[model samples]
Target: MDEIVTFGGRVTLGQDRQADDTERFLEMVGDRVRAARNRRSISRKTLSEISGVSQRYLAQLESGTGNISILLLRRVAEALDHKIEWLVGEEDPYTSDAVAMMSLYRQATGEQRMRVLEILDPDNPHLRRSRRLAFIGLRGAGKSTIGRLAADRLKLPFLELNEEIEQASGMPVNEVIALYGQEGYRRLEKQSVERIAATYDSIVLAVAGGIVSEPETFNYLLRHYHTIWLKARPEEHMGRVRAQGDERPMAGNPAAMDELRNILMSREALYARAEAQIDTSGRGLPETLDAVLDLIEKRGFLRA
Candidate 1:
């Protein structure tokens, strides 16, 4: 058969098919970008500001009339707090119910999806199954100290969630955040928690303070772990950070303490959702450790 002249020049059937496939892929990407932005209620202007891409270009991309570089598209995906693979229709290795919910939300239309979201509780009781004990709290809440001591006394392995995240990403937490932003960091955090849950039968995990900010990840933690909130005052948190030679907590912020207080206040309710609480405020290290040990014994978390 003779090749057809699809354009000004003669083109093979294979070439025409390839061109069609490329166009279809671009259109799919555009649709996904628009859907994700809509799901997040993010305007083009907001995405442009966060992604450093021009608003005009974003509009064009969404409309499937613009050609975008992979790097630029990655910036947009990161800004939307979505993985580029998800946006581009690639399978995620770490798929879960929560991840599926996120995908469904992105792919659904308005109003009905909002109602669906409202009905789906991230912390539903059906999801709860205690396998390990996890300590949650503000930055200086003695999660590391108390958790480690309790784990040692009980003959359980102790792991810090932040350290795990750093290990998984092969970089410091600060670097992960710098390279991938908070959204990227949270994604890694969720994956790390999942990996830990599957790898360890019984362990003591000290979760990141801001893990609560991501509902799906936090809910997963709550479901798979016997969670305990380790509470401490804002002053103690600041003091501990300072003692560790991390002055960034108080650097260049006159209202740092106030900000810390506000964060604790905002997250109080979330922290309280833990199965147990240990208030470490104004207590010595030994006393705090004792309290944690006692709480674990009393609550029967070791066998949980």
Candidate 2:
């Protein structure tokens, strides 16, 4: 004797449940296929011509009455410029925006992918109004000088990121670097930024010049702060470093100028991703400050 199942006092057979599940699956597949076709503005006749599937078969598929083989479904998916998994509801529905994002993601390198993920991450802090403004650029690009002055004028707190890192580790940055190496420094850098982002609502941050080299940390900063790239000519960078009484720019490395140029060249693209930029070359501190203030005003970054 076959056992019968009762739901709500109604007897149900196992075959009945299997049949219902199959029907639901078919309906879901049909709905997704129709949606994908409509989103592309593709007609069944056009799809049939491209995919070599019959118009009648496509119509049946959309109506949830036809069974489709994997081979035929692949052909239809290719014609609609969608993945098979997307058409079959195995993945999220494909919108034009999602399609474009996926295409860009596929083409991005690992570091670039980290930056992209920051933008796409749902929990990104900067998705809301960011309270911090970060200045990014090579050393001697006026990030410290201009960022501090901007913070004063804006009546916000100013923080140098390296100092923050040192404080967090209870050691100077150079010592931290010497003990932990570059990878360890980057890990600490990320932790420090996370802490600062959580603690401050409105602040000005001066970041290290090589921060961009660590994509994960840099991406987090991009998402949590209003970033501005402080730009300067290579000669100006060296001269300004020297002016600050820091001979480290030329100390121990005779090819320091060439090295500086190479570093700038490599980081130009990453820095350009900042929300805004100010060229500090040939500009006085007051003039540069005014430029940054003007940008802030224009962007409505400061909350009333």
Candidate 3:
């Protein structure tokens, strides 16, 4: 004999079809809540005690014989560490960030945030085009410039790994080394490269000139993606670097120029692991780009 007020008007439970629909919806919600409780291995008595709803009332709701107030639903959901919408057979709201690419989702009301997550919960995450492009040479090489341009050409993202590590640590690269020491910087650099590699697909990586110091990361790149070695003459490198006033590479050594040459000579084996080598001596942007493109085609990266 109880009357339920619906959107259209007052409805008596036995006489109104719309009231029947509401009853069906309520039954479904109660069934869902019972299932959730069972999934967590909670019995009705435990749930009733913990939620402070009487065991008989809780049983009536589970058996589709009792009405649930909004307040009761809220209390039950909170006791279960979930949202009331979840207990009421509505979608979970915690998954909104997964579908940030949706235009309407971006503009949706704050209340719709949970609804968005429920929508995207069943799909795969987005893919990213990222890669690693290491510039191998002594100081003054065109790694940053050429790497950026190549990234632009391929329509891929770019990063100076050294700069990323420095920014992430909030200190200069040398200062990090001076403070945390050499092994610490290498650890940071390795973690950064691995994290980027796993997250992105097409990227131009600009590694430090000394990344060959860690052979593990070097070998991993060679095994996984196309590696490009940007090479130039020692004199050309020194000229380019000195023009930019980066004197650290040349300081405290009488034969710093020869030392650079010797350094390249020592790492030549590692550099040779690159899929393609570009000798940047006297080569401007166009010629160097053409050379790289030709190599990319030859390596079967881009088909005819």
Ranking by TM-score: 2, 1, 3
Candidate that beats the other on TM-score, 2 or 3, i.e. the better one: 2
The top-ranked prediction according to lDDT is: 2
True lDDT of residue 154, candidate 1: 85
Return the lDDT, model 1, position 119: 75
lDDT of model 3 at residue 263?
A: 86
Q: How close is every model to the real structure, measured as TM-score?
A: 0.57, 0.59, 0.54
Q: Per-residue lDDT for 251-298 in model 1, tens only?
A: 999999999999999999999999899888899999989888888888
Q: Which one wins on TM-score? A: 2
User: Whose TM-score is higher: candidate 1's or candidate 2's?
Assistant: 2
> Which order, best to worst by lDDT?
2, 1, 3
Q: Tens digit of lDDT per residue, candidate 3, span 1-304?
A: 7688889999686667777877888787778678778867988888888899988888888888788899987877776666676666444333444333454666877547445654656331211111344455555667788778877887878788888898879999999999999898998888887877786655677788777768887666565456778888888988888788878767887798888899889888888777678898998878887787677657654221
Model 1: how far residue 265 lies from native, Å: 0.7
The C-alpha lDDT values of all candidates are: 0.85, 0.86, 0.73
